[model samples]
Target: MPTPTPWYARIPPPLIMLFAIVVFVAVMTYVLPAGHYERIEVAGRMRVVPGSYGTVDSTPIGILQLFRAFPEGYKVATPIIFICLASALMFAILKATRTIENAVGRLLYKLGTKRAELILVLLTFFYGLLGIMVGYENNIAMIPIGAVVVLALGGDLVLAAGVSAGGMTVAFGLSPINPYTVGIGHEIAELPLFSGAGLRSVLCFGALAITAAFNVRYFRKIRRAPETAIGRGLDERGLALAKPLDEYAVSGRDWLLLALFGDGLAWVLYGVFNLGWFINDISAVFLVVFVVMAACSGLSLSQISAAGMKGIAEMAPATFIIGMAATVKVLLEQGQIQDTISYGLAQALQGLPTYLSAVGMSIGQSGLNLLIPSGSGQALATLPVMIPLGEALGLSRQVSILAFQVGDGVTNLFNPSLGGLVAMLSLCRVPFDRWLRFVLPLTGIILVWAWLGLLVAVAIGYS
Candidate 1:
């Protein structure tokens, strides 16, 4: 076994990426623009610009210079800040009402199963399927509760965490209706919102189905594996970081939750009906829902503000990590890195025939997802390059779409930089090594499922 690094030497993925960005920026000062490159346009649901890069300027200065130019990177990180604040407030409110705990308790009690291994598999399926409708952030909030369920069932904590993490990724990965990232992928690839919906839905459903089957097999092994298989007994130290289950109010909180749920419904309707309310300003919808939750919860303005602040604090680390990720976007934009990657991969697979391009694309997309954890951002960077290549190679737009979704969703299972993944890890106190041991097999299973979906897509006129 590889020796684990000491605590002090363990570097977070965001920090490692940031260091790479700094080095890339420093080097770009000398050899970019003059080197082989392409003019890139970044258009997606979200965009990340390193302050070090000039605003569409033709200047030759390194993007690193822009970092110094804008010292308050927080200004550039506004969305991240808002997201963090909202998550923390949501968590606080959920805790204050004990609604989450009560809900989880009820779920476990109703399960009426003595075999924990069976329940864990079922939980993964439920959560993963629910994710098709809700965002990963919403679904991940329930993971810690899943941990308690696991502990009670005598299953491994790490395995339970994997169930949540892995399940959530498979759900979002295969979702035909991901309003954020998939929407961005469609826009960048110039596919209609309804363009590949049928095939995409099929692929998504297929991935989830296969994921469900594989998790069942894996958890069976987990149930049989001795507790000693886990190096350190599952640590519940971070349970302290979570508000007590009783703190979340359930009865009076229903109205608040219902309102929030309705708000979420309205948001979904706006997407489906193409409502002008959503078209004019989507952010306004999030704000309105937030306010409604406060009002229904009977929270005073001060209490709400305090909750929001707490939520922001909890999410502060994520904010910095996401902001640093923006710097990597800067490097790719300036260096034509996306094009370079696309071209190199395309050339290497040139002799494999057209069907293979879709395969290569799926692999490339999965790999890029590691370096750029955000699906929206990755799609924006790669789709234009990949879609056109796929078209030229006689592949359908649907294949590109399915390929992108599968690639984006699979890597999400363990990427530490992703807000939901990191939050689940923290909330559950599952260490990186432990998370890996449990998830790697499942991830491999999902990867095979992804390719199988791609092959099906090819067979069904997608290629």
Candidate 2:
């Protein structure tokens, strides 16, 4: 047999991004004229200006000036790094206490032997709910469990990989509670905090159902008929069944119970009783609660601190990716590339029909999503351009919001700019190819679903 490929040979997302950035800068600087764009105010004076974008000098002078003039921009790295460290430390402590393994085992056992289809569907739905409640950044640790489930059932690894990544992609893209992208989009569109929740939730659920069905069909094919005559091993499948708690002395049930109750109570109070404190900033709250749980679970101050540090260490690469992406944003702003792209798209497509502009604005925002990476950042950058265009086209603010919601959420399924996506990859040990295999088809399905949903929303007088 040929030698197995080394892990690092896989797609190097950061390096590829660097190349793209260089090419973008080269095209924007050398070929494009300085006066290619005109200053334009967007969304009732949102401070957006076009022309002279991506102007950072490729020379040493420009490089030196960047660090000297805008030291504050680099500070954006702090929060990402801090949060990651805290998460790593927390998970490590949980691992040491055996709570993480125990919790997963209990979950698998409770799931029990039943209709495999139902289990898969329920698991997919759980992923969507987790996205809404926990945020995608924190839920990636569950992928190994997903893999174990697939293998345990004698399911195909490819099918298992698809379901695991696909479910996450849908949840993340349609995140109900994520303030980063969806929240920013709503703000730019001037919609309420919970605006588009009805439609967004429905889309998330619909995507989950569609993905579960696809995985189930694939699983059946693998189960009923074996394509290869070679022996199919079951080592990976047995992980969930193995007694992981035996390795660690303590399971920390009380601590886990508290964590679950705390999480549940927070969600209930926020969603049902209108407790603003819990929902207003859930991520911060989650961090606090998990930290407390670590301490209360019989961990010493040193252990808790160490666990937090480890969590942050795990997040370092993700933090770097986010920081680099942000740097590109700064470059875009300086070079006036963002506005130029926005205005150019608007001006070039100005002659298109009215509804086309509405749809195009959404599509345009999605295109920006690839570059901006952060949903919130993209919304802040692009929504100013799109919302007004929507208004000029006689589309309602709601339509504008819906378009953004769909566009912003859908593309993160595979975008490397997303820290959560990287976290998911690390947790699952799923390669980009494996992730894409499962996600591409589901992405197409959701893309069509979003368009149809937009049409339906318009027909129902949302606009």
Candidate 3:
């Protein structure tokens, strides 16, 4: 008799999982009520009127449109897809030059395995800090570098992805100064911009501590017992084992290339913060970095072209999944139930007590993130109602915003509908099931922290 397939074999791959979900949501388009809300422009976003929801003619997507959503996802997700492909191509060319390998080798030579955990801690904090300051969607290129460093430090790809994406996810959730989420939220809630920074800073620090401690503990665990990691057989820390430290050293050319890489990133950051650059601008910078670095590394033109193609090929799986994830969003919008769901969720909070209402707002936001993953979009749609609802429940608008912050922020860590999360995990070769196993526990703990923080905010009359 043939051997049985493993239990996980029954589960669909990430791409298939997304396809199934998109189909399910497409079906629900017919089943769920269709509605819309009147909107007014505020702070460059369309804010929903608090009491303007009305039933509209049902507009469920047909089978043709359902199939069309996949291609639409590709079109809709193009910007982030560009960023993802660019990062992959750049790293592939960098690998051709052995820059990452030699850099990890030199660092290991100086730090040894025992001391490398510090690098994890610091990188996590650095990423967390950048996210706190810069918001989201600008750091896709940098995460792989952190993952590589972690892989070199004797952890599996899961841990590598964990510390890098994990830290950034946390910071994005609790970002006090983020102009997109918190700033837009503040403007919508009629609060001073960055007004509640003190409490938010504390919340962010406490959450990062929890994340860093949990990940570092796991890092130490697999260090001593590699069998225990979810990625045990799937990943390896071969930087030290691939060759002796003595055999690997950073050259003058590597240093110059490294500096150029830093300059490229600095330029991207400048464009993002100063010039309002986004995906296209950032992708252009990465492409330049790849071409320049490949030239400096002395690869022939054909070799350079091959490396770029190979990088895009390697990234195809993740890139495809990212596009499919967008299909779910497209289907949701196509059905016209997006605002109906938002209206119903808001209506449910009408009679709850102050504390429960605050918590409920966060819960509702988390649920809505499954539908509306964009922070600014969610804020515009939900906060108009949530703020007033919280005020009616004897809760401050600040508490409601905090609830939105935590609810909106933490879900990105593993929300499959959020393309960035799935894309990052796929790039790291972490399966969706394994990612949930690792992140769900932290997600639960962070939700609790969010609840407790909300309670404290209410107790102190936070405004």
Candidate 4:
């Protein structure tokens, strides 16, 4: 009999997939006609005029340019890359101080095993809230701590992933302030940034509620019958690491560190919402918080630098993946084929009813997300085309952005191209197949909810 390849060996790494995408897009530059839309300034923002797409001189990216796309993409992706690196470093320093572990351990001790379900609900909601304010890629750094907490509380790896990374992915899709998705999405659509926040915030909470309920149900199932648990096959090392709740007391210094973190988070929210902060501002907030926390924890400058560097090193692959994903956009733009694809999609949508067109836009964006997983990158690549398409189909730009919110955000839960989610699952030691089994149904439900949300937006002439 022929030997079977291990699942891990069979799946190519994310970078390889991204490289393949680069080659594919380079080929597309030759096969697809080059085109562009006429842009006009609208209240200081540039937007594509509907019905202005025209074939342009072919600007096919040569093989050499395709090779150079990595550096070019890195330049475009630098802001997001730095933000992720800084957030990872901040959390790394927190881990080095053992503050997070101590805090979570003490909390688990007080809550006890019987009330463990509440921990699931609370942690899920907390992570979801972070998703709304901090952005999802930034939240990946916290997943291991969440996994440890859930595991120690007698929950399995899947539950840990659910409450942390899983919950965050759900909330991120529904969030009004994700910056990467909603922020850039609104900007590209030329709507005010976070303009429909009231509706989005309500939807965010609803999605979180659904995620919490789903996680809690699975947690109970596993607790009642460990034999049937999804994580029953987890290695001995992982099982042993889930320590029993110890009597670790929170000291004055711990409280101070916690306060710093809380205040830093509040400042970030204020800066983003009130002051209109972008990626660079958010990264600076994390850097400042890390430094202040490190000083309060009595770590010397050398130790803080070491911890921060280690955090960046740990996240290096994910950071690289971000740059690589951006290459897809780079290649498409260089080839001048993005607008061509957008025009084709728009023309196809013209024949559909207005409500169906809204739904179709959401569906199309979801499909696009499979290939381009970075929310900001996808937003930059697709929203310009989708915005005009929405107008042509009698749908408002707000409705189009809403479609983007659901499509780009929700699909991340299952998209293999999403390096952050893949890294989180790896951190929790959960298999991709197992995660699919656990999340597929919830994704379906969320998609239905999203479709309904779009229909409502269209019905009310949402703008």
Query: Which structure among the candidates has the greatest TM-score?
Result: 3
Best-performing candidate as measured by lDDT: 3
Model 4: pairs clashing at backbone N, Cα or C within 3 Å: none
Model 1 over residues 225-254: C-alpha lDDT tens digits?
Answer: 764445246555323224433343446576
Residue 264 lDDT, candidate 4, scale 0-100: 81
Off by over 4 Å in 4: 1-11, 137-145, 176-203, 224-243, 299-306, 371-401, 416-437, 455-463
Candidate 4 residues 303-336, lDDT tens each? Answer: 8888888777766777777778777877877888
The better candidate by lDDT, 2 or 4, is 4
Model 1 CA deviation exceeding 4 Å by range: 1-14, 17-77, 115-119, 136-157, 179-192, 195-199, 213-313, 334-340, 343-349, 416-420
Ranking by TM-score: 3, 4, 2, 1
Give me the displacement of residue 426 in model 2, in angstroms.
1.7
lDDT of 3 by residue, 261-372 (tens): 8898898889988999888889999999987888898778888788788778867888887888878778877888888888888889889988888888888899888767
Clashes of each: 12, 16, 1, 0
My TM-score estimates for the predictions, one after another, are 0.72, 0.73, 0.94, 0.83
Candidate 1's TM-score = 0.72
The 10 consecutive residues of candidate 2 with the worst lDDT sum are 229-238
Off by over 4 Å in 2: 1-15, 22-74, 133-169, 175-201, 218-315, 458-461
